[model samples]
Target: MNLSDYLLAQDGHDWPSLLSDWAEVLPGDFIVWIVNRLGDLVVVLPDGSVHWLDVGNGSLKRVADNREHFVSAIDEGDNANEWLAIPLVDACVASGMALGAGQCYGFKVPPMLGGAYEVSNLEPTSLAVHYGLLGQIHRQTKDLPDGTQIKFVLSP
Candidate 1:
């Protein structure tokens, strides 16, 4: 899939709230314009800098000074592979997967639970569900040891 295929609507208002649980760790206010295969966000920060919100791991970091730099950075070899995840996207597409406008490809077993970075672990999911679940799960398990056995229970 082409990189442009990943660009979500630029309306920032909806994203922050949809992913609010995962976005609490962000460096302040921002707008989400893109999402990677694992449902990570590419956001333009208040200072005109672009940052990556690794929702799966609940981490954020600046990717470029601005949108222009962000475009170049995303197309530049390694960053392209990591940020765009074309290969994975293509695999998902070929496997008969489809996502709605408000959805993305999300991990069936998130990395925090030892999910492998493979197409077999992906599914089309609403952004709210992906980030909300990951945010809660990661927060609960962030301090646990690698092999620590713990039960993950979701409650209303």
Candidate 2:
């Protein structure tokens, strides 16, 4: 609803000072701090841009191309019994959606299906970059956010 509400929802991460200079570059009225826990932060701009604020390095990077793709990644992780916090990763699963198609490659046997695999390779797609950056951030901190939740209203 407002900045206080956003702060409360995000555990009061001092956003006013964090995002003060970017007022001209970022949307003003409807900024939402969607997630903040375990050192990860996510915010949704009014224009539907999803950004991941790297707490460790204090850098903000757009992790998803748009809200739709971010939501899709969340749903994919949910369906795979995984959580969508920061870094927006999909668990290693045997399905048409595994490894995000081109960003990764691996083999899966019968019982070993859906097991995690090395990211044999990477592409230039948002998904690949997200995965790569996520891995890089993860190397710094193995503890992921406590839970995954998307409270924004989905548009038609």
Candidate 3:
């Protein structure tokens, strides 16, 4: 798999609408500049810093001080691989999983809910649904003790 395989910054993407679900947890104002197959985002904050929004964990990390630096940071060392979820994306493709338009790779059972990060637990899901549900779940569970029991339920 290559950059094209992981890119979610396609033509006509309405990122503001797509990223609205994350407002409760995100740091300040920003624009979703890029996204990977996992729905993880690379956003630019108003202060000119670039940050990575880790979709699964609902966490954010500053990757660079500015857009120019962000470009270098992304290509430096293993930053690209980890930030883009390249290994898992590769595995999913190898396993015949393909992400369609408006879809992303999401954990069937999220890691915060005790699920492994293995590709076997990944599936193609609507990015909006995944982010909306997981954002609420993460917000609710963010302060719970590590071993706390979470009665997870799923329904169609």
Ranking by lDDT: 3, 1, 2
Model 2 bad stretches (over 4 Å): 1-8, 11-14, 17-30, 75-156
lDDT of 1 by residue, 20-133 (tens): 676457655677767776687787878899888777666778889999998778777688777766778878878988877767889988876878778898888877788788
Question: lDDT of all the models against the reference?
Answer: 0.76, 0.38, 0.82
* Model 2 lDDT tens row, 1-156: 122211113433355544454343345654555532222346777767787654323345676767777667655534212222222222222222333222222122101122232322212233223334443433433343534332434599
Model 1: runs farther than 4 Å from truth? Answer: 10-13, 145-147, 153-156
User: Over 4 Å off in model 3, which ranges?
Assistant: 153-156
Q: Is candidate 1 or 3 superior in TM-score?
A: 3
Q: After superposition, how far is residue 35 of candidate 1 from its true place, in Å?
A: 2.2
Question: Which candidate's TM-score is highest?
Answer: 3
User: What would the per-residue lDDT of candidate 3 be over residues 1-156, giving only the tens digit for each residue?
Assistant: 467777775467666666677777786578777888888888888999998988788788888999999888878999989888888888898999988878889888887787777898999998878888777778889899889998756697
